[model samples]
Target: MTASPEPTDAIAIPDSPLAVLQQVFGYQSFRDGQQEIIEEVVAGRDALVIKPTGGGKSICYQIPALLRPGLTVVVSPLISLMKDQVDTLVANGVAAVYINSALSREEMLRHFAGLRRGEIKLVYVSPERLLQHEFMERLGELELGLFAIDEAHCISQWGHDFRPEYAALGRLKQWFPRIPVMALTATADEATRQDMLSRLSLTDPLIHIASFDRPNIRYTLVEKFKGIDQLLRYVAEQPGQCGIVYCSSRKRVEEVAERLLSRGHRAASYHAGLPLELRQSVQERFIRDDLDIVVATVAFGMGIDKPNVRYVVHYDIPKNIESYYQETGRGGRDGLPAEALLLYDPGDVGRVRRLLENSDNEQQLQVELYKLNVMAAFAESLTCRRQVLLNYFGEYQREPCGNCDICLDPPKRYDGTEDAQKALSCVYRVGQHFGVMYVVEVLRGAATQRIREHGHDKLSTYGIGKDKSQEHWVSVIRQLIHSGLLTQNITRNMVLQLTEAARPVLRGEVRLELAEPRLVRVKQKDKGEAVLSRAEDRALFKELRQLRKQLAEEADVPPYVVFSDATLTELARYRPKTESELLGINGVGMRKLERFGAAFLALLRRQE
Candidate 1:
């Protein structure tokens, strides 16, 4: 980190946002939609930004924070997020501090003094702290420039991770009418975006919704069978890389973490059930690259700024697309190739549905169940996973994304026109009032009590599919839902309902093709795909990582805070021989070049 403030001369034109981007943040140019958003904020207009994670959302505000006058107050959701961002900014020679519970009273007062002296460009605070009367009043005393609310979706109930404290943030606009408020989030659907605009009272904000596609992330959905073995195999393939495995329960988290440890992986469990200090330690360890994997429940991984997460494995399905997208988007933040592997089981659908049904709020439960069905549909989708994901967020992509598993290895198809007709006919005959399990049972000639009570046994469709296994029928039904020939009504007990598209298929007017039932027990590929493909580059990258880890240990910061893996990969790829060439790299600013240039240059010199 720089020992003193960055000289104003570093940015040749202090008021120019592009100049500040290159000089202070070391980016050669603004990413698409970033420069316009930054200019809007700098021009004193509110903005609601809906960009995907790793999409440079921070740059939309950070550059403006530097170019605009006065201190920019950023509202972040987690202390770790604040600290990581502040550390990154400090490393880049920008004066930034986070005011949160982590700080001692003396440290808080020192930061307050800095703020009073106008020595800090940005100050981060939590929503709860920002709402405190004294802190709110104290902020009024400063020459406030902008209020950038990170994870702004938390303010809305419609968002995946809603916090009541965020709802009170609308007072910021009322308290400081002229200070432009920029609410930014990586995950927000249409409803969540509208709710945020209303809840945060963003005044006629410029809404910039960047394409929600992470092309670098390869989406893979694997059927869950012997899930522990599958998880172990997946993790084994990515040895020594940092990743997160998300489970649905604390017990599952512990079990997975224990199994991983037994298999000799650097792993730990994190959940709210653990002691606060233990959770904090696990998080810190993971961020520092001391832990190769963290098996955790949904309680973890909000506002995580670790850019080099190689993969995110969902040991179980997520509750919604927003949660799934945000969680999986945690990987490949460094614009490097990464993977999102979800081990999906049909049984998990019932478990998740039951969990959501317990919610006392009927409206909320309905919303959750609807989202869960959509999540399941995505998992069971036959088409491009990226297409299904992006289509849900209202981004239409006609062309298939070649990075996903479906595109890479297309499933074997068969002429299942008769089976599709059978499934569709069964749904219609059974009155379309049952879930997949019940429908499958009816089709498979199961004489269960519920079936007898409903008199479904006497229906024409009953036992029509007896030749097919229950798993086969279930796959057919799910595929039909994904093909848009049927819809599941979540509020009506997730009953199967035929859509208009099903009419033609049921009447045999349109031939249908479906995937063969995926019951074959398969093994994960044992190959490890390294980002640095060449042996010599990988060797140099390893040495650079070692150097970074040593420096981070000495500096008491996460290794990424020194230099992201992406930057290190670039350093290894393009062996810069001089200071100018090194500074030309994307992540190296003047401050970092001055601080660690000679050490890296010496290492490169030795590599020669």
Candidate 2:
């Protein structure tokens, strides 16, 4: 709860680092909160950065890693993530190495030896590895300059990716108390932040809570009756663009990916249940732009550095706002325009509620549920998306973002003061033991078999909402739930209950801007053969695909198992004539360029 210190004027700025940041990273200047956080880390002070997932949290640590002396030990949560970060670091000419479960004993020992020799400037390790006795002893031998905990929120039980080993990190202070530790996370609410501080044993750390507003990301939440058809239409409209579709389960991930593939789109499935090799292959393909879309669970995309992702579609609502923010942050990292869509239903909320009940820590569970309530409010809110998100992070955003769906096409809001009172009265009369559907049915005068069986049709409030349809009543109830006027009783079969905040609204003391009910409209498809007018370019693209197909075939891989269409599109667009140019593409690497660059370039030249 402490405020961040005022910025000091004594910090020196070098033109070289600024030039690299602007020219290579393509940023004009540091964002408002970024400079102070960077200076604090540069000064070797322990700091905690709570920025929104696309708010440039990486830059906070990356800049300090570049400026500080000695190597920075980055403890990440996943093995695949370490590989991605190390690859990017090496690409940028920063000496980096990773030790993870993927490595053999000897291989890991070699990396540990490298760390002791100070041969690497950045060493990425998983929390599990850090818990190993041998790895701990090896780490003790190294002269670490800075200890960075990426996704630091995971150290708290409240975080989405909470790992038991992260709690073990408190022992780091025992070994190297003098070394500054910078904990960086894209999403952490106030309670989660405090939990992280206590769990990590951070000493009076400077907290940098950046504004969570993402202006480039236009937020939209739609009723999810016809989600798949809507998703297909949205993706088809943005042809060849990279995006991620997040589902709740592995089964859904595979099903969605297969459905997209069947519809003639480049897509793939990713989840933790897959074989390590298969997961790596899918991740490589997606990163290389060999796949246009990746249907994945929350397990994917941690520390993924792909910047040009255009959209993130949530097939189900996440458990909390932190999870949602981090997942959506995956899109639009390149500072380009992107969209985040959440397709959800009342069933999704039930699923999340069950998950909360199943968690081990009751306090953390309550905190997470509260965060979910906030996210639900955001989804059902009639105000600007940017404003709601920023407000959650304790920042005031006055004006509408103009880019979000609600801002572009504002929802119709009726004066719901009286309706609020009726809903509240109904909940109170029904004994707070019935769910939204039952409550709504009673209000709509629906005398279905269940309603009559419960004898609710005889109640005075049973037909009060006869003027509105069932769907309309449901929307009003949902909005009221989000407004803190109503609470879902998870223990009592997820029933609706009135809270203290409901009194003013129920008594017609406060006006509420409730959103209108949304309808799902199916999209029309175009049935025509795809045409290519650029014969020469099309021929080159074909040859590139063929060559990729050949390489993948030799490797016993899928077509996208080699290079993605995005890479091919870039090849066709840039017409890169050399291996060097090819290596500069988003997903192309030195290994790939060395192996297949010549053939791709030769085909391009032959076409010319």
Candidate 3:
């Protein structure tokens, strides 16, 4: 949050975007659809891009800024994102500055003067600033190159993290009809994309929807049993690494963070309830590699640009797929291998329901509940996890992605038509007035006082499902709800109700295939067998990591900015002994090579 602008001499106008890519960002080639998206925006046209995290989205608009004549105004949603992006650009020797509430008025005037003089190539501002009348009038006077809206999903009402302020950004397009507007996001579904198109008023735009796949990330989901024990086991398994544990509430965040700290991990808690200065401080420490883990709510990860987060553990299930995807996407941003696991329990659905009950908008409420059911289906699926996730986003990948738990060990599903019929018949017999637990008891023929009082014991559907245990029946109930043969009434304590699709299952018109329940009544091992540690080149890897920390501390930057753990891992394995050998490493650019390459090479020689 410095008040000073990045120093610059004359601008280096690149002949093409490719020149800027190599010289500034240090990439030999554009990733996925970046080349096409950049070509469209650089040629003065509107574009909408949906590239996955770590897919080099920033470069698409950044290269165009280098090639264009005037300052590119980037509308970023987070102050942390603005700061990190500007820091990286300035570190790369590009003149970039950010103006937000974090800056003083004097600093804002100075940066605006720099922009007026065309000294700054990129200017990062927030949605609030863009909506101001004075700012727009002043902006209209300048020759702006383009408008880059990072986290463009915020423009959509259906987006997981929507901002009312972003709805005002559509006026930016109308104010400067000639300046191209590029809306970019890493997370958005079909609804969100359409909303962005309509809100930004992008006409006949070049929409590049890149594949939403992170092949390097391994996905795993386990039922919650002794969850904190399991978390400890996983954390111990991955030694000297960074990860995040996402809880559903601020209280849970504090409890988990405390538990981890008591176990001797450098952990912290983050949520909306924390002081703003404390939250900002924790984020800074995490980014600087000063902490190993941060237990947080969903509010913590939106502005995180750290590349070495090795894993993300969802202590409870997220409300919807969009939120889950964005939170987990925070891992493996360096294009290195990462791990993600969600410890799910049916009890979490009750929490989700309670949260949704408070929302006043009936239309949005229904939409959110439906999305929650879809997310529950993903967590419960016995087939490919990636398949169900991608399908929800309107991308169909027929073949199973072999990177997830289900793909590795698929569950054997049994023909469940008779069982489903029985469940649906019971729901109908019970008058659709009770929730899952009571219904399960009815199926198991529990002679509870409520059942006796309602005369449910005399019903023909009673004791029909006695052969299956209560846990198995509960799992079946969840699956039935997910399969659309049943719906949960949100207003009436989430009572079980039948939708039109339930008729087929009840009438034997459709057959259901359900995964055999594997409910572990007894506690399993304390530590899971989901091993993620890859201590490559042990001896030199240790030295390289220590050196990286030293350099990061000196430069007051993240260790990743000095050289990510992945790059350091490569250095240790290859043991680059010369300048040329160091140059061949994946993340060693000219600036890095000049700064620390010789020192690393000297260490390799000493080791030899």
Candidate 4:
């Protein structure tokens, strides 16, 4: 679906990228690497960009499309994402259209005509549609300046979310050899990056990999016990806020949504099992601010581009780290403070492993199992979550983020050299053939039939340290594995094996420090919502949001398409009272000022 272009004063086309930035987009300057990427693409060269979500990735291509002479074809993965972006671009007065299933035959013909007439600067199409031989022939008729592949990681089989349709995108460079191509994605490991470069045939591409750290989004890991109660408490902490709760199964989604609804929450469940119309309806309602929470499975994945999503909760652990990172990145897209709470259960790890083991492809199962192990390590980590996350992407950061659950309320640490030796000795005594649970039980002197059958009660290491709880021993073993002192062989029944580094610890030659296992959950302090602090400022911000909702409803677009929460926060803080002052805000472009400036200024004046 296309946005209804609003009536506004004519815009004077800017010649340079920076000029387009100021005049068309209403921003005074470019964010970090944006200008460089824009210039590289405009200079007729292929490039690869890896930035965090809400890091202005769209601007890297959109500006070049405007400054360059011909149409820029954007290969998008999802119809809903294309619509959200195209709506935002159109609202900014950019000549952009998306050709997707949402468009009727007549609407598609109109967009085609617009493209042929050189009226649309940018066109977004899915990989499946763009790969069609007939569709490629039709696009060849247009003056093509550039081809941008959004979510480029999808092209790689090694990526978290591989789409076979995206695999055919390498043909874009072959068809339009001279035209520049830019492949962009927010989450891609080094392997994924290399795979994309080879698969997409990006020729000596100028690579710009931004820091993976998202300072605005706080990371939290909560041990899952009485999970539904914990989830309800967390949801209650942020009343009237919009968030997403992700479950691993459809039944769980329905159960959580029902519980929330029974508790008088504006919540709904979305999954692929639901009717297409109902799923669309739920998505529409949530985007329009009529629903505060949508409990969903991954089937409700990446069609969302909602900038105001304040939080994302994973009711169960994800299969891999990339999926976890991308899903959480959906929150705080406005670069405002948001929260990501992961309710991690050890049982969930076993469930995911069992599912992965069911796969016939042994190689793929190994890859998936490795990824899950890393994800579990992240959840069980006592160090900074951001550090672990960034380290996974090969971006090193030594300092603590001070925002995650671990950093906010650090667990106490003590010299556990004896504990380490005992745990290591037990793994060795068990013939290194047991998983974490079996090892923990063996170490804790668990009185079970298996332990009896194994004749482990007669061993010297058996029950050597029965003073500690089962959880404490388990935590010790996990830390040992994380520190490279041990390795869990997923292919071999997930048995624990000592690493070379464990020799010193096992020999009692090296001291080890380990964090105390937190038996109880610490209450994470809530830093109030994005940017509005004072009572008066919050009141004004609320009023601004009400106005935004009304305008967005009338326009039939998401509220963020009108203006981001970050921009509204600035309005509330600075209290811009004139057209000039409102135009000074980051999101208020020439088109927006002409269309919305009057209403915002009037409200500000009234508040004064």
- Give Cα-based local distance difference scores for all models: 0.83, 0.75, 0.81, 0.83
Q: Which residue segments of model 2 deviate by more than 4 Å?
A: 1-29, 372-377, 414-608
TM-score of candidate 1 against the unseen true structure: 0.69
Q: Provide the clashing-pair count of each candidate structure.
A: 0, 2, 0, 0
Q: TM-score for each prediction? A: 0.69, 0.67, 0.69, 0.69
Q: Tens-digit lDDT track for model 4 on 1-608?
A: 23333213325578899999987888899999999999988888899999877778889998888877898999998766776677778777788888877777777888888888778888899999898888899888889988999999888867777777899898877888889899999898877898899988888799999988899999988767568988999999989999999999999999999999999999999998887568778887898999999999975647466889999999999998888998898899888899999987788999999988998876666668878988987887876788778866767555678999878877678998999999999999989998888888888888999999999887888888788887778788877765667776644656888877789988888888877774432122343235556999999998999999999898899999899877887788777655544655667777787678888888998985
Candidate 1: what lDDT? 0.83
Q: Write the residue-wise lDDT of candidate 3 on 1-608 in tens digits.
A: 33444556434656887888887778898787888888888889899998877777889898888887787999998776787788778878888989887788788888889878868888888999877899888887888898999999888777766778988888876788888999999888777898899999986799999888887788898767567887989998988799999999899999889989999999999898987668778888999999999999987776567999999999999988888887888899988989899988777988898899899887667667766876886786665777666655656655678999877866657998888888889999999999888999999999899999999999999999999898778778876765556766644656888878778778777777876764422222233111224564676788888988988899899988988666776677656665545766667776898788877888887866
For residue 348, what is the lDDT in candidate 1?
96
Across 1-608, the per-residue lDDT of candidate 2 in tens digits comes to: 11111112212323354654665456799876878777787787888888776677777776777677777888888877877777765555556777766777676667666667766667788877777898777767776778899988888765656667788887888778888888988877555687788877777788888777777888877756556877888888999999999999999999899899999999999998999888888898998999999999997998898889999999998877777888888999888999898986656787888878888877667656766766676766666677666645545554568987678877656677778788888888888888788888889888699889878888889899999777678777766664556766533445777877777776777776665554221122242112345777677677788789898988887877577776776676557554434655655776676667787888776755
- Candidate 4, residue 424: CA error in Å? 15
Error of 4 at 450 (Å): 24
Report how far residue 84 has shifted in candidate 3, in Å.
0.8
